[model samples]
Target chain A: MKLVPLGDRVVLKQLVAEETTKSGIVLPGQSKEKPQQAEVIAVGPGGVVEGKEVKMEVKVGDQVIYSKYAGTEVKLDEDEYIIVKQNDILAVIQ
Target chain B: MKLVPLGDRVVLKQLVAEETTKSGIVLPGQSKEKPQQAEVIAVGPGGVVEGKEVKMEVKVGDQVIYSKYAGTEVKLDEDEYIIVKQNDILAVIQ
Candidate 1:
């Protein structure tokens, strides 16, 4: 929770991929696709461009959707984290 | 330039892949890699999360880096555009 992101970036903890559908049938882990959902832990301080300031729109504690293929993956304390630009986020879950 | 992206999305015009290096030696056009750099054409109205409004950080005309494999590709009037979430964008060119 103490990680400080820079320049409109976000630190996310990806949700675990689901193995069971709503129908209650258990599925093999291999059949489940990677999860695009994540929980926001840290937010960037924003950046500047052409004399204009670009501020972070995502905040801490937001549940967001992101591109599975985007972002750099990292591991700390056996927990996975992904560092992505704010642009890579698809949506914030209400 | 008139496209209105939705929900933290952006409209990007991908830069052409380089076939020639600064030394002027040219690679076959077929062998050139796809470019991940793009020019921002339009930006979405940011969405809401947890009763807070998320605002756009990227603006039009930003030359940005992005994930090559992300976004939806579309063509209008022979111009190609990629609609990507804001998080898919990596960096803005200064």
Candidate 2:
């Protein structure tokens, strides 16, 4: 199923969480940190907001870092996706 | 001390948290929610970020809503401020 994000919103598939520390033994699922990186799947066409032209900066295929507690998680077709406003995204990894 | 935010970052002074619900009985400070609204105090110059020309959308004096879990909090001269990237700002209240 395709995901279509609405205004200033985006859909992202999370990157894998880190399972090991510097010492090299893998940690359990319960000890894995929340993933902050993700690949953009879809982006909304930003429009007018409060008399300002909201611009969509990040596009599909861009890998981004987002706020940990900022997005809503959804499961569709057994795949997990995160939906978040553009503002919650911290940066686009080059 | 004067605050000068770095590229695409903004300095904001938080708005007061609600002391009570609609019914109007004052609540304790510990029960107050984290403030989501803030007045812009300073704005950073728009600059290049990740090969993209990052533009500053909100100006000084705009009241903005930011991600609740985002931003770095700092205190100077007995004043508290939140420093956040432009993307962490959700909306400007016009």
Question: TM-score, chain B only, every model?
Answer: 0.72, 0.77
**Fnat for every candidate:** 0.02, 0.00
Residue-wise lDDT of candidate 1 within B19-81, one digit each (tens)?
A: 445532334545433337779988878765223466778899998877644466543334656
- For lDDT, the strongest prediction is 2
Off by over 4 Å in 2: A18-35, A50-52, B1-7, B10-83, B86-94
iRMSD values, candidates in order: 13.3, 13.1
Window of ten residues with lowest summed lDDT in model 1 chain A: A24-33
TM-score of each: 0.45, 0.47
The two-chain DockQ for each candidate, comma-separated, is 0.04, 0.04
lDDT of 2 by residue, B25-60 (tens): 234456333436779988867675433578999998
Q: What overall lDDT, based on C-alpha atoms, would model 1 receive against the true structure?
A: 0.65
TM-score of the second chain in candidate 1: 0.72
Badly placed stretches (over 4 Å) of model 1 are A18-35, A49-52, B1-94
